[model samples]
Target: MISVQGLTKTYGGFRAVDDVSFVAAPGRVTGFLGPNGAGKSTTMRMMTGLTVPTSGRATIGGHAYRDIPNPGRHVGVLLDASAQHAGRTGREVLALGAGVLDLPRSRVDEMLETVSLTRQEARRRVKDYSLGMRQRLGIAHALLGDPEVLVLDEPANGLDPAGIHWMRTLLTDYARRGGTVLLSSHLLHEVEVIADDLVVIGQGRIVAQGTKTELLQSTGTVVRAVDDAALERALAEAGISSVASPDGARRTEAEARQVGEAAAHHGVVLLELRAADGAGLEELFLTLTSQTQREGAAA
Candidate 1:
């Protein structure tokens, strides 16, 4: 299991990660989610000891990442697939990692095969590999030691549909075999399909964390009307508060039926109404982090 307790990182006066805490339990896939500049990468870096935290700690199996001798054997990490040396072959890259981990050279070949890289492909220089191929190579390197925990950042960045499906199956099987998996991604749909638990971050802090079902059930409802002003007034008069959404307004207390009744009672024309229970992850993420987005400067 991976545990993060009050982990924080600061640069100058900026807080890159602020007292973030979450656990990636064994036999489960935890999706680390956030928008651009939400500090997902910073948190992952702290967990791996790649970046020292200003406070708190991240541990694997009760030991800090730096204190774990032969850490690759306990935790596999793939923070940047493109960080590999461009001149080296995929096989060479895995071979170096195996040497560092003191694993037999045969393990390198095993990992290459495990990641579906053909012998020919493994021999080619990394500079010539496609982004998907590089991602595959990176995953193979991470798994070469057969670690109990896996931390991957944007593993599906360049994958096609088939490759993405393969990754889903691979990670799912790994978790089933008792491995802890923490996958970070901005793609809500992909994470929704595979993650058992979710840790959502915004502005360097955790905004939500729970099982997929628990989080989805917590979202209220979405409603719209022909006259949005009238619908808003009706909802207000009925004591149900709502928040603005792209399509309309969403409420945490009222269900679609309740909102529809209010609209009818107030003589407001109802155009759209739906319970947000088990709503798409995209909707949940957008709603949860609406105010935390780093808006680009106007051109």
Candidate 2:
């Protein structure tokens, strides 16, 4: 398991990560999400000990990452797929990693196969590899030690649809075998499909974190009327509160039936009325982080 408790990182007056806490439990894949500049990378850096935190801590199992012996054997990390040595062959890269973990050289071949990097491709220098190939090589290196925990940041960045599907299957299977996976990505749909839980961050703080079901479950009804002002007034008179959604529709905690009745009673022309059941991760992510994005845009 990975436990991050009140992890905060500050550079001068700027707080890159602030009081972030979440758990990536064993046998589960936790998707870490945030918009641009919302500190997703910073938090991941802290967890992997790439950056020092101003306060709090992050640990794998019960020990800090730095304290773990041969950490690659216990926690596999791939924070940057393109950070590999440009002069090294893909095979050479994994070989060096295996050496660091004191694993047999054969482990390099095993991992290359596991990530679908053919022998011919692995023989080429990393500098000549395309982004997708680099991603495959990075994943191969991460799995070289067969670690119990995996922390990957944007592992799907350069993958095609088929490659993305392959990655999803691989990580899900890894978790099924009782390993823990913490994945950070901007690919909302991919995350929605594979993540068992979610941690949403904005402005350097955790805005929300929970099982995917709990966070994505419908909280209300979404309705849009030809006369939006009239609909709002009607709902207000009925004591049902509502907020305007990003798309100009009104979302209310009341049931769809209740919203419909109120609109009908007020002679409001309804254009759309539905339960918010399938809003999905994209909507939830935007709603949770919208304020931070607006602030960022303003600045």
Candidate 3:
């Protein structure tokens, strides 16, 4: 298991990561999510000991990452797919990693096959590899040691739909075999499909963290009426607070029965009323991190 407790990092007056705490349990895949500049990468760096934290701690199996012997054999990490040496071939890259971990050279061939990199491609220099191919090579190196824990950042950044499907299957199977996986990605739909738990960060702090079901469960009721202004007024008069959704519907924490009764008492005609349970991960993510997103910056 990976435990991050009050992990924080600051640069001068700026707090890159602030009081972040979450656990990636064994036999589960935890999806780390945040908008641009919300400190997702910073938190991951702290967890892997790539950056020093101003306070708190991150540990794997009750030991700090740097303190673990032959860490690659226990914790697989792929923070940057493109950070490999440009002068080396894909096969050479994995070979060096295997040597560092004291793994057998044959492990390199097995990992190349595991990630579906053709032998011909492996013979080419990493500088000639496309972004998608680099991603595959990086994954291969991360898995070469058959570690119990995996921490990957944006592993699907350059994959096609089929490649994305393959990655999803691979990670899910790893977790099924009792390996811990902590994945960070901008692909919300894919995360929704495979992640068992979610940790959402905004402004360098954790905004939400829980099992997928608990986080995605309906938080309120959604209702629409012929007269939106009148419905709003009715709800206000009934002491129920609501927010208008993009579809001209109002979502409130009040139950459906309460909303319907309020509309009826106000002599308002209701067009639709239901539990607001259909919001998917994209909607929830946007809603949770809307304020943290930069105005005109690319994520």
Candidate 4:
């Protein structure tokens, strides 16, 4: 299992990560999420020992990352696919990782095949590879050790829809076989589709963490009217509290039925209304992190 307790990182006077604590359990995929500058990446960096933590601890199977013997065999990390040596062939990249971890060279071929990299493509220099191909190569390098835990940051960033689906399947299969996975992504739709658990951070602190089902159940509904003020007034009259979304949509804990009835009673015209689940991952993400969002004036 992957564990982080009271993890914090500071730069100058800025607190990049603050008291972050969560666990990515064995046999489960934990989706780590946040908007830009929410500190999700900082926390992941700390967990992998890429950056020093100002305080607290991060561990894999009860041992600090630096203390683990043959650390690559214990945890696989893919923080940046593009960080690979552009001069090296995809095969060479994985071969080097295998060598570092003291794995047989056969493991490189195995991983290349596992990530769907054909022999011809693996022989090409990484500088010629597309972002998608680089991602595949990076994934192969991470898995070269056949580690029990995976920490990937935006692994699907450059993948097409089909590639993303393939990645989801691969990680899910890994977890099914008892591997731990912590996946960080801005793509909430993909995360929602595959994550067993979720950890949401904003402004250097964890805002929410729980099983996917639990988080979705707590997400409320969003409703919007041609006249937003009218909708708000109607909801107010019905004793339902709501806050306007950035786009003028209003979100509330009230169910759709209740909101509709209130609109009818107040003679208001609703432009849109949907449960949080029906609205999909975007609505839930916006609602949860709305307070921390950094908005700019109209262009």
Candidate 5:
């Protein structure tokens, strides 16, 4: 439902986003992730038309955001989730939001309750609301028009554990019902739980884009066994390469779960079977980006 092509944004000499391209499919939540100052937010802003790109193009359903009628109704956006009128009550703010979207007043209350902002709190000024409350309020505002596509930046930032779970569940449900969700987050575990697809950025460029399973599969894993010598011999016969630990420790992250099962069937003693850090999506992200940065610096 969303496509970004060669979307590049530059701030003088620094490129915030560079030649990034990806697609957010309907009926799925796509994780937009990157390290600190990797231009994740900049990319989101450009996609939502809050900030124009220096070059290249992004579109929703084949049209530029500005060309969409009632873009708010076509896309729900919660950029900060904390920016709100300090003096306005949650209800008033959402009500005003409804007006802007030409939605009914009931939508205001519906979304307020949807985000679990109690009637009492809804009546209180936004200035009195906690960070989480403000975030929910921002979410309520975003949902006021019941848009089909959602672009969220750190939606779970300040939410409590339960709140974060709720947010994840809600996003999942939305996608299940055919909503397109493009969420940018720094929380890898959180994204791992919710995202079916991922688009990773580093130094303003997209380094990886695919389903979670696809990205995870891209980097092979090692599984370690307690009987290092025996396991290494077995793996060598099986055509798998493994290194011996300095202490004669035998370990492998060679695809974890399934490999463990296979090894067990082969009578490989179970010592420790878990994913090695260097072979997962997280490791791939760090290794790829850091290498790129080092190369850029050396040049």
Candidate 6:
């Protein structure tokens, strides 16, 4: 439902987003990950046609957002700040946006409900909104036209844990219904749970993109084991092997569960198993981003 090719965005001499490209397919949630200042918001803006890329293109269903007829109905976007007339009620604000695209007013009411803002709450002036309420209003605006593709940047920024959980389920459910969801957030663990795929970037360039398992596999190793000696023997017979460490602390968190599952099937009492890559994702992200930053500096 979405495609980007060689997307490049620069401000002055510094590229905020460089050569970044990926796709958000229908029926899947694609998590866009990067550290702070990695140009994630810039990339989202470019995708929504809010900001023009200095080079390359971002398209929705094969058409550039700018050229797409009735873009409001084709793409839904919630960036960092949502602009609404404070004096206007939330319902009025969403209705105004939907009206511009000639969408039915019922869609506006439906969105308000979908985002869980009741009719009375939706009637309250936006200026009275809390941060979480404002966020929901922004989401309501995006869903005003029932767009096929949704792009949200740091959507969980001001949300409480409950709100964040709600957002996760909502986005996942949207994708499950064949809509395309592209979300950018710093919540790696949350992404790891709901995202079917990930696109990781640093210093404005995509360094990785794939299913979380695929990306995890590249940055680390996957250890599999069976609890039985026979299963261990089977793995050996199948040519699967793991490195032995004196302390047996090698299994990285990424592969620990898989390793445990493997060990259980084999009936082998696994004393230890771990990813050979040997580090938590927090460390992995730091190493990866720092290395990219160093490369950018040297270049």
Which candidate has the highest lDDT of all? 3
Over 147-208, each residue of candidate 6 has an lDDT whose tens digit, in order, gives: 89999887877788988899989988889889999988777777777889888788888866
Candidate 3 achieves a global lDDT of 0.91
Tens-digit per-residue lDDT, 1-299, candidate 3: 99999999999999999999999999999999999889989888988889999999999989999999999999999999999999999999999999999999999999999999999999999999999999999999889889999999999999999999999999999999999999999999999999999999999999889999998988768899999989988987998766667778877767899999999999999999998885688767865665576751112
For all candidates in order, the CA lDDT equals 0.88, 0.89, 0.91, 0.88, 0.79, 0.75
All candidates: TM-score? 0.86, 0.85, 0.86, 0.85, 0.78, 0.76
* lDDT rank order: 3, 2, 4, 1, 5, 6
Assess candidate 4 and give its TM-score to the true structure: 0.85
- Candidate 2, run of 10 with poorest lDDT: 290-299
Give the distance in Å from residue 225's predicted Cα in candidate 5 to where it truly belongs. Answer: 17
Q: In what order do the candidates fall by TM-score, top score first?
A: 1, 3, 2, 4, 5, 6
Q: Clashing residue pairs in candidate 4, if any?
A: none
Cα displacement (Å) at residue 211, model 3: 0.5
- Note each model's CA RMSD in angstroms: 4.3, 4.7, 4.3, 4.5, 8.1, 9.7
For residue 266, model 5's alpha carbon misses the true position, in angstroms, by 36
Minimum summed lDDT over a 10-residue window in model 6 is located at: 244-253
Supply candidate 3's per-residue lDDT for 201.
98
RMSD of 6: 9.7
Error of 4 at 20 (Å): 0.6
Q: Stretches of candidate 6 above 4 Å error?
A: 218-284, 292-299
